[model samples]
Target: MTADGERQVRAILETRTRAFGRRDAATAAAGYDDDLVLYDVVGSFVRRGEDPTGRLERWIASYRTGIGHEIRDLEVTAGADLAFCHFLVRISGTMRDGTEVGMWVRATTCLRRQGDAWTIVHEHASVPFDADTGHAVLRGEL
Candidate 1:
C-alpha cells in the first residue's frame, strides 16, 4: 500500500493531467496548494502569489479563444507528497485575431502534498529545445 503522502502526490499528477487534457480549469487549479507557485512558458510566472485562479482562467482562454496544447514525454518525480513533472508541450492554432502559429515548450512543475491532497507549489518551465535537433530534449535525453 502506498503511504498517504505518496498517494497524494500521485493523485496530483493524475488529476492535473486529466484536468489539462479536458480543459477543466477549476479541476486543474484544484491541484495547487494554498501557497501555490506556477511557471508557464507563455504566460507570467506566479511567485508567492495567493491566486491560481487567474492562471486557470488563462488556460481557459487559450482553449476557448487561443492556441491549443498537446502534452508529451511527461515524466514525474515524487518524494512522498512532494513531486515535480517535466514534459514537452506542442502548441498550435490561431490567436483570437486569426493569426496562425505553432510552437513547443518544455517545462517542469513542483508540487506538495497537503492533508491527503496534492497541491502545486512551484513550477519552472522553459523552451530548451534546439532547432538543430528534430525533437525536444529533456534533462536526461540531452
Candidate 2:
C-alpha cells in the first residue's frame, strides 16, 4: 500500500511538472487543493488558494519568448492519506528583453489524499540567500 501511494503521489508531481513546463497554469493549479498554501520563491509573502495562479501567469508572461522547466533529484514519501516530495527545479527561458533567464530553486510539496486523488495542500519554493551580500544564490547543484 505504501508503494502504491508513493507511485500515485509521484504521478501527481509528474503531471504538475509537465503542466508547469507547458505554461498551463490551470492544469498546474488543478493538482493543488482548493485551499492550498504556497510560499513562493519569488514572492515576499505566502500565497493562499488561487492567488498563486495569478503569480504563475505573470511569471509565464515574463518569459515572452519561451520557457522550459526541469525537475531534478526528486524524493517522495507517502503514507495512507498523506505524502511529501522535494526536488530541485531549474527554470530557463528567454526574457522579454532578449536576455536569458535561468534559475535553480528548491521545492517541497505536501499532499493530502481525498478519496483516490492526491492534491497538494502545501508547497514551498526557495533559493538560498547569501547572508553577507543579501543576494539570492541562483546557481547550484541538484
Candidate 3:
C-alpha cells in the first residue's frame, strides 16, 4: 500500500510538471487542493489558498512561448494517506520581450490522498541567496 501511494504521488508530480512545461495552467492547477498553501520563490514568501494559481498565471504570462521544466534529484515518501516530495527543478523559457530566462530552484510538496486521488496541500519553492550580499544566487548549478 505504501508503494502504491508512492507511485500515485509520483504520477501527480509528473503530471503537474508536464502541465507547467506545456503552459497549461488548468491542468497544472488540477494537482492542487482548493485550500493549497504555497511558499513561492518569485513573489511573497507565503501565499494562501488560490493565490498560487494567480502566481502561476503570472509566470506563464511572462513567457512568450516554449516554456519548459526539468526535475532532478526527486525524493518521495508516502504513507497511506499522506506524502511528501522534494526535488530540484530547472525552468527555462523566452520572455515576452525576447529575453531568455532560466533558473534552478528547490521545491518541496506535501500531498494528501482524497479517495484515490492525490492532491498537493502545500508546496514550497526557493532559491538560495548570498548571505553576505543579501542577494539571490540564481546562477548556481543544480
Candidate 4:
C-alpha cells in the first residue's frame, strides 16, 4: 500500500468508526458517495442511494447504547483515483429491549476520489453463518 494513499483512505474510514461509536447517522452518511450501494449485515441485504442516514438513524434508535465497532486486519489498495479496503469489524452493543449483541463481521469498501476527497461508493458487510442450522454466528471471535 502506498503510505499516503493508505493514510488518506484510513482517515476517511475513521469517520465511520467515530460515527458508529457516537451513533451519528449524518456523519456516517456524509462519507458515502451520493449513489452508494451497500450490502449490510442487517435488515436489507442491498440498498442503493435511498436515504441511508434516515435508515441508520432508525437503526441506531433501536439500540439503547451507542454501537461499538473494532476494526482489525484492515487492508487497503489505493490508486490515483480509486481505492478499496477490506477488514474485519466487531459490532457490539445493547438493544432497547435489553438484549446484548456482539458479532464479528467482514467488510469491504470501495472508494473513489471526488476532487480533493475520497468517498465510499460501495460497501459490503456480512457475518458468517452455520451451514447446518443456517443461523448467523453473532457472538464469536473470528
Candidate 5:
C-alpha cells in the first residue's frame, strides 16, 4: 500500500480505538455502517440492530470497569478503495470483584471508501486457535 493509504487505514482504526477506550459511542459508530454487524467472541454475541453505538459505549465501560482489549497488531490490506484489516487483540483488566481476566483474539474488519472517507461494511471477529484444538473457538466459525 502507498504511505497515504496506509495512514488512512491506521487513522480509521485509531479513531475506533479512541472511541472505544473513551466510551465515545458516536465516534465508534462512525467507523461502521448504519447496518453494521458484530460478533463478540468473549460474550458469544451475534448482534444486528438499529444502533450499535450504545453497544460500543457499553463495551468501553465494561473494559474500564472489568475488562478491555488492547490492540497488539493491526494489518490492513487495501484494494483500491477497500480494506481488510486484521487485528490481534489482547483482552485484559480486573473486574469490580477483582477477577483477573486476560486473553488474546483475532479480528477482521472489511471497510469501504465513502467519498474521501472510509467506513466499515462487514466485520467478523474471533478468538485465536487453541494449541490443543488447532482451531479458532471464539466467534464466527474462525
Candidate 6:
C-alpha cells in the first residue's frame, strides 16, 4: 500500500465529511467522478452517470437545521492508480418536519487517480437489515 496515496484518499474523505456537515453540497460532491456509480441507502437502488451534486443538494436541503456528520472506523487501501476506503458514517440532525434523525451507515468508496487527484468512481452506502423483519438497522455501533 502506498502511504502517500492512503493519506490523499483519507484527506479527500475527511474533507467531504466536513463539507457535508456544513451543508456545502458542491464541495461534498466534488470528489466524485463524472461517471460515478452509486448504490445509495435511500432513493433509487442504483444511479449511474448522474449529477451527484444535484441529489446531494436536495438531501442537504431537507434538514432544517445544520447537519451533524462524522466518519468512524475508516480504513483505506491505496495503490498506484486506484484506492478504496470503507467507513461507518454517523448522520444526525433535525429534518424540516421537526423530526430528529440519526443513523449509522456503512460506506465504501472506490477511487481512481486522475492526474494528481483521486476521484470516486463508485460508492456504496447501506444499512444492515433484520433477517425476519426486513427493517433496516440504522442506529448501531460497528
| Top-lDDT structure, candidate number | 6
| Residue range 1-142, candidate 1, lDDT tens digits | 2355555655665675566656677777777777766566655555667567676667557543434556777776667656777777666665556656466677677776656566777877677665888655433432
Model 4: weakest 10-residue lDDT segment is: 133-142
TM-score for each model: 0.66, 0.89, 0.92, 0.93, 0.74, 0.96
Give the top-scoring candidate (TM-score).
6
lDDT of 3 by residue, 82-142 (tens): 8999999888889999998788889999999989989999999898989999988767644
lDDT of 6 at 90: 91
Off by over 4 Å in 1: 1-23, 43-46, 62-67, 129-142
Query: Global lDDT for candidate 3?
Result: 0.84
TM-score of 2: 0.89
lDDT of 2 by residue, 14-49 (tens): 776787668777776677788898888866678875
Give the runs in model 2 whose Cα sits over 4 Å from its true position.
none
Please provide, for model 4 over 5-97, each residue's C-alpha lDDT reduced to its tens digit, 9 standing for 90 to 100.
Answer: 788899988887899889999997888888899998877778986887898899889999999988899999998889999999888899999
lDDT of 3 at 3: 89
**Lowest summed lDDT over 10 consecutive residues: which window, candidate 3?**
46-55
Off by over 4 Å in 5: 42-45, 63-68, 129-142
Order of the predicted models by TM-score, top scorer first: 6, 4, 3, 2, 5, 1
Candidate 6 at residue 89, lDDT?
87
Residue-pair clashes per prediction, in order, are 0, 0, 0, 0, 1, 0
Q: Ten residues in a row with the worst lDDT in model 1?
A: 133-142
> Each candidate's lDDT (Cα)?
0.64, 0.82, 0.84, 0.88, 0.70, 0.91
